[model samples]
Target chain A: MESDKDNASLLGGKLSVINVGLDKFATELADHDVPVVHLDWKPPAGGDPKLAALLSKMGT
Target chain B: MDIIEKANEEAIRRMLGAEPVLINVVPAREIVPNLQDKMILHAGPPIEWDRMCGPMQGAIAGITVFEGWANDLNQAFTMAASGDIAFDANHHHDAVGPMTGMTTVSQPMLVVENKTTGNRAYCAINEGLGKVMRFGGNDAEVLNRLAWIRDVLGPAMGKALRDMGGIELKPLIARGLSMGDEMHQRNVACSGLVLRAIAAAMAKTSDDGTELSEALAFISANDQFHLNIAMAMGKAIMDPVRDIDGSSIVTAMSRNGTDFGIRVSGTGDEWFTAPVEMPEGLYFAGYTEADANPDMGDSTIVETIGLGGFAMGASPAVAGFVGAGAASEAANYTHRMSEICATENPEWTIPSMDYLGVPTGIDVRLVVDSGIAPTINTGIAHREPGIGQVGAGVVRAPMACFEQAVRRLAEKLGIS
Candidate 1:
């Protein structure tokens, strides 16, 4: 998961209303260190470490 | 017009500006658990007789034999054919049933009372997995489990309720809304709350710790037991607003063994109904589309009133049964529901709607005007009877029902 600061920075580039890749989003978030609250139901095959951080943090 | 006619007429008047609502349910029983059974307890609208697949019919026969209403499978069929037994939706009686939602007076039903209007409804417990009536498989195991629930669990809970005054589920629901439970698919928080409250009261004067522990464990294990309460709470909350004069707020969403039906508050309680179909989504291992039952039970009332699928975003985990698209569809479902509603819930709000207030109240006019049918987040069962649950999916109320409702409301309200 990315830090809140990095997440804020990456939100614009990573998030897309239609068809945004979660991997790219998670990676960008990780780069910036933004904390993701949770993961979408299906992951981007093989799962992402950023997603793990988000789930543990979110307690889902 | 006489009272009955007046009641029916009143039902019509409420259909004008129906708003949707979110209702949460909690058990008044001291201990809650997942009552394990041979069949997965399916909930919601019933399937049509002609439409029933093999499993559904089998479950019906199984229920009869389980209840001792019939001596055997052949006798059960004979009784059904003779019409000696009444086949009514749990919704009609203000009750909810799990998948395949079958119930009889003999079944120990949980009567949930909405204190606001003194309106009460009943629902049978969810028979957890395997050969349960809702899944449409009937066998000795199913019958024995039914007997156990009625003979033991029901009575024990009755005593506990008597000991610790009736419970108020309203507060728990309000709190659960924030936690992650939509009070439908994700009731983990709500379940815990129910158990905690009841166990505290039961501990005061209970038998051994083993009995108490076992009961508590049961509720913790089953995620769907609270569905009955949610259905009742929805019934209770909506009952107060039912048959309001010239109001289009929908008050009740229910299904008989054959049709999916709803009552608009301003439409004067006249039921607009349509045939039910299976919802498409994920299901248990080994269960395929062929293993499911059609929509069953009265629990749809919960979703109809706004808390079930519409609030799915709250419980992201719900993606399992309803499938992945959980978050966005949660909002989408809420948005679709808003098309039919007259107002937002002043109280309940689903966080996934970005914390937007739930689409409260189903309005007939809005439904007809927009042509966007309300989307229900539901579990899909096999089209044939007796096969049990094959998967889960989303479905919609037939558009014609709302169209007719709007037209009728227009006539009653003298709208051009």
Candidate 2:
């Protein structure tokens, strides 16, 4: 639970971001001297279209 | 504040204050001032005839036939190849359109006016899915649909709009942002809202209620019916911000099938263009990535105003179309846009952000420094002429465009 003071700090403090989808964005943010964390994300179920379809079918 | 900051603030102020009202629909030549008989307006920055991509060339050919300038496709092609017909960018004429995005003199265009700034913008009526001219369908069926939209649909819509006094689009767009429409990839809710606003007026304007109902039904079925109006509204909103001396805010982002282009407020009318990137997303059945044309359209205006891809957090359903595949990823995509924008537009709130404003006023300096280009949701036309839309997806404005604009802005500001 973040307190009011913590929330305020978060709003105006050192900027950091968790960038997914494209690594280029993360690289660019770093070039600008902005603090950022890049998380390489992929579709679930190891990106197998059929298995992911089944997982969606099971509502997971 | 510095010059850039002051200019950016002024730019954003004009954008925030815009009140787009759909006043009427009229032929492109009648409403669009100085629209000459031989001149054709297309999406994105200007390109010569030989450089235009297949879909754009195909659309020009179709428009020529529609205008009776040529009797057939071959003759139209010859006319175009010979430079008998002139081509200019839609932005140059205060107009915009979706893919292939060629607007001829006689085509009916929606006229949207910003009551706040007294600026007006025009956009062609959306021809609605499959076998449409905008997507490069130039056959008789496509031409016939254009005629119907020109003759029957345009008059009916114009009459209905006139009956209502005018339909205010800004508030409706505000409602739509909250109701799962970013007004580009998915306009289902806004389409419904427009119908609800004008359905009564539509009925009132026509004598034969059945014919009117059929037209209304056609509108009801096309979820993207409100796209042209929204685009025109964006144009109306953004036109007031152009040439604002030192503003680094992007005024336009559009693409021809071959190239993508951007214009910064401070840079006046100069365009920063780069090679277009093909969109990556699910294709319609029987279509694949190889068949996809490079992204095209003036629909990117939605993104320029902080809707389309920027408001995706509020439109979780768009995840599938843009390949996010999950609501959280869509939300993150919207959050990412804020990193490059100058400010958020409080008027257009994204519900998922706890009603935080949608990110507005894309700053070229921030974009260059951050290296994050604006994301756009778009319809993919088939690369070949006349096949129509193959799929829909997301693509980024090329980083080179932002870099180029930033360099120009820096030079203009006398900064190293």
TM-score (0 to 1) of chain B for each candidate: 0.82, 0.98
Q: What is the lDDT of residue B166 in candidate 2?
A: 87
Q: List, residue by residue over A1-60, the lDDT tens digit for candidate 2.
A: 889999999888988888986699999989999888887555544454554443333223
- The A-chain TM-scores of all the candidates are 0.26, 0.52
Q: CA RMSD for every model?
A: 12.7, 10.8
Query: In candidate 1, which residue ranges exceed 4 Å CA deviation?
Result: A1-60, B1-56, B208-210, B324-329, B352-354, B414-416
Q: Rate residue B205 of model 1 by lDDT.
A: 51
**Candidate 1 lDDT, tens digit per residue, B1-416?**
13223443444333212222222222323211232222222233433444544555677778778766778999987776665655544444455565566665456666566543445665666666444666676777777777767765665565666667666676676678788787766677887777777667556656667766666677778776677667666765566666565665567665443566777766755777777666667777877765555555566677756677666656666755677474545555666666556555545776655677666666555555555566666655555545445666666677667655655655565554
- Fraction of true inter-chain Cα contacts (below 8 Å) kept per model? 0.00, 0.00
Please state the error at residue B395 of candidate 2 in Å: 0.4
Q: Per-prediction TM-score, please?
A: 0.73, 0.88
